[model samples]
Target: MKPLLSICCTSYNHENYIKETLDGFLMQKTNFPIEILIHDDASTDRSAEIIKEYAQKDGRIITILQTENQYSKKIKPWPNFLFPMAKGKYLALCEGDDYWIDPLKLQKQVDFLETHSDFNICFNASKIYIQDTNTFKEDPFRGKFPEILTIKDLARKNYIRTNTVVMRNNFTLPEWFNQLPFGDWPMYLIMIKDNKVKYIDDVMGVYRIHSEGVWSGKDKAKMIEMTLIGLDMLIKSNILPAHINKILLKRYRKYAFKAQKEKFRGYLKNR
Candidate 1:
């Protein structure tokens, strides 16, 4: 069956958590057909074997188990690989460390987008699972948000939860996207360039904040620095129009000031 949606996942040394992730994919209740794309980036762990086990059992699973690591060579798996190969009209993201709690997550998002032609994507609230604290808390921005969002609103910031995202599969990302330290922010920026996204007012998934998390585990200073770097790179790439660039530039300055304060706090602590 040609899938109407594709669940895109990337795994690396996630043997401990991959099974839960696979279960999350398996548990989705959708009216439309969906394909699962698991791109294992040559994990030295047993991640590949676990993926193989699942793929052998499910025909919907399409696994690409690489023998050599690509991320180490500055190659990202999604944009360069799994994304273009998606056979679905829409794509949903869920990292190997995260899982969906609401079985109707996909159905809800698809229903909204299928009815609304102007929107390119939709996402909902997700709980944050803090491993060190062993607590599941509401998303930081559980506060009210516009039912529809555009790049104009997002340019100032990106509070969108990646794991909750379900976006149109039509957009093409630049090759330079691989160079960005973070992919979701810029990728969504591109997706909503001339488009808008829907916000579903429901908690549907869990985003694990663990020490092993690729970015979530990073120190505050590093995460801020990466955000700044990605913004600057996007601005330099001139992908978005000049007006959008203006908004990004303002955001860039705000983060720069925050970065300076972080440095000062570090300096004070060392004294």
Candidate 2:
């Protein structure tokens, strides 16, 4: 039977947390079948072994265990590998280090998309767990998200957490997407370009923040640099309107000033 939803997960060296992540998927109670497509990007740790253990138990769990790390080869595993295998009406994203808190997450999001034909994407609020501090932070949109979002709203700031997103899976990924160092923001921007985005107020997932994570662990300057490069690529793509470009440019300037301030503070502290 063809699945109505596909849970696309990507991970590397997440042995400690992969079980929790897998359990989250197994606990979901949905009216329709959902396929779990996971790709372990040549983890040096026991992540692949853990994934294999779950795959052996459940027929719905599908996996790709790479001998060589795809990210090291500059390959975007989600688009090139996992997404191609997703045979479902909608795609839900969650990294191996993250876990869904609500079991009805798939049912709620799928119900929304099924009823609202005009909306192409449905995402909910997510809590961020900081491993270093051992603290939980509320999602930015916990109580303050608009009922509906547009491409322009996304351009201003990325409030849609990747783990909570369940989007229509019919569109082809842009060619430049492979070159991006990051994924969520670009994916959301492209997906919402012509379609409407819907936000669910419920907190459905947890985004784990650890030192081993990519964006969260990186230095502020490098994060800003990479984000600017991505925004520039989007602007040059010419898919977005000129007004959107202006909005992005304003954001770019804000990041630049913030980065500069951080640098100045560091210099003063050293002096």
lDDT (0 to 1) per candidate: 0.89, 0.89
RMSD of each: 1.3, 1.6
Cα lDDT tens digits for candidate 2, 104-213: 99999999999998888999888999988889998656765587988888889888777888999977787788888788887887777677899988888999989899
Tens digits of per-residue lDDT for model 1, 148-253: 8888888876778878999888889888888899898888888786878888989988888889888988999998899899999999999898999999999899
Name the runs in model 2 displaced over 4 angstroms.
Answer: 263-271
- For lDDT, the strongest prediction is 1
Q: Which residue pairs clash in candidate 2?
A: none
Residue 258, candidate 2: how far off, in angstroms? 2.9
User: How well does model 2 score by local distance difference test?
Assistant: 0.89
